[model samples]
Target: MKLLAGAMLSAILLYLVLLLIPGYPPVGEIPFYRDAGFSVIAHRGGRGLVPGNTIEAAENAVDIGSDIVEIDVHMTTDNVLVVRHDAVIDTTTNGSGAIANMELSDIQAYDAGFHEIDYPEASWEIPLTVPSLDSLFTALPNHRYLIELKPTTLPPADALCELILEHQLQNQVVVGSFHSSVLQYFRRSCPSIPTSLGKSEITLFVLLERIKLGHLFNSPGYSIQVPIKYKGFNILTPEFIILAHNLNMRVDVWTINDPKEMKVVSNWGVDGVITDRPDIAISLRERLSFL
Candidate 1:
């Protein structure tokens, strides 16, 4: 037992020395991170203020001083990519069906802007249908976008990649997905575009950070878009943010709407705050700039 313990202790000492001495190569900066700062990313294009993922919400977010208009995309049956949060249109739109199973023309017949909360007396005449990715790019030519691809049986990466290339939006967009496979496909298909860490990659990063092996992690994404807490564990600490920076990766915390929490994370030196309230985030950024 003593001999085994001594051997284990020696191995641990060796690891500590190696960890403390060796220098790792810093990750190369991506085009998306060029001159980037504490960005105010409008989640679903400021969903709290307008109908989520609609063109109006996107315009509102940009006009209110958001640095990035975040949106979600799902491919239609006819291979057109539409802006939406869910795989199905049941919750957000007037008509209902799976996005992948319906053609774009069929899908747009439903009013996506008919939010009961925003419009208590929702009218069919006030029809703001789902906008195509192509239309959005045409409308917001100079804006930055963070697009999350919803997981689906119909592969959307190739279509999305072609569109980005067609629009010459390589530098203005960061693509992300909850499914790592989808992100992998996108990365392979669209090498010029930057991407946020997928769910599995995020899990791997957290695990490595906890074990003090963060420096050894070779991240494939340009940034990580995470919630402040996941399953009750705080994920956005100063240490976590530093580790990401050390790896040359940007850290973007998501869905933060509270003024206090936004201030807290901004103070911690996060690269971006993804919020449904860009108005609040922009206001906070202005207040902090003077300090």
Candidate 2:
């Protein structure tokens, strides 16, 4: 009887090992990570690799395997929407005027590549023409876009929404703005596309406000651009991430560069991360098999 009992116990232990083996593979095992669809968004078309907000930059980001190319949008004097980062062209381009004050033709005269010396390998030259939103959309039809609406005087949110819907890109775009009022306008006008709320600070009050407003506008996600330093004191904490998850609202943090911080935040199970160096982010993700 004792010998029979020992054999039965050995059989039970072997079965348990077989069950655990499939769940937790041995170290150095290469589990399929591609099943996870975590996105790597290029912040301003990956400012680390090329001149920001330019077509070349966007292309480079795509070549580097970024899931989305983020761009900023402003309006020309004639109210034609164009892809650009700043309200003015003085810093990013050779032209020295406000984008809101210049005609599309006038904007075409500036050299966006002249000041892009930080990336010597890019070999970008002067006389970079500003690209219209339509042109960018046509150029990269396959790539997903994260469009940031700059605070400008021209092209009302309603009109922009019309154009976006006209192109049938309502499902492929994520729109955001620093101006809450502008985002609110977008939310009211374009209910089909997802809108992200950008805020400099995050608080429980702010999170509550975002949640309340999000429900009103039916926004899919809340975006916070600040650092983790804002987590406990003023902004949403890890607890907030938990809360957002419970509410079924996605959370996206912006412009995070540190790999360590990226790992930490990714572990928090946020929906996405916006970063300037997508290459580094991709490497980290690959190393850890996070995505």
Give Cα-based local distance difference scores for all models: 0.85, 0.68
What does candidate 2's lDDT look like per residue over 1-291, in tens digits? 999999999988875665455221111211111222577888888877887787777888899888878888888778888888878888767778988888888987887777754343465654566788887777787778888888733245766787788788876777777776677667777777776655522333255444433222222343334456554543435765665544444556676877887887888776567888889888887889764
lDDT of 2 at 256: 80
Residues 90-200, model 1: lDDT tens digits: 876878899889999999998886655433333434578888999999999889999998964436888888999999999999999999988988898788888889999
List the pairs of residues colliding in candidate 1: none
For model 2, the run of ten residues with the poorest summed lDDT: 24-33
After superposition, the stretches of candidate 1 with alpha carbons farther than 4 Å from their true spots are 1-23, 117-125, 152-154
TM-score of 2: 0.75
RMSD of 1: 2.7
lDDT score for candidate 1 against the true structure: 0.85
TM-score of each: 0.91, 0.75
TM-score, cand. 1 = 0.91
Q: What's the CA error at residue 50 for candidate 1, in Å?
A: 1.0
Clashes of each: 0, 1
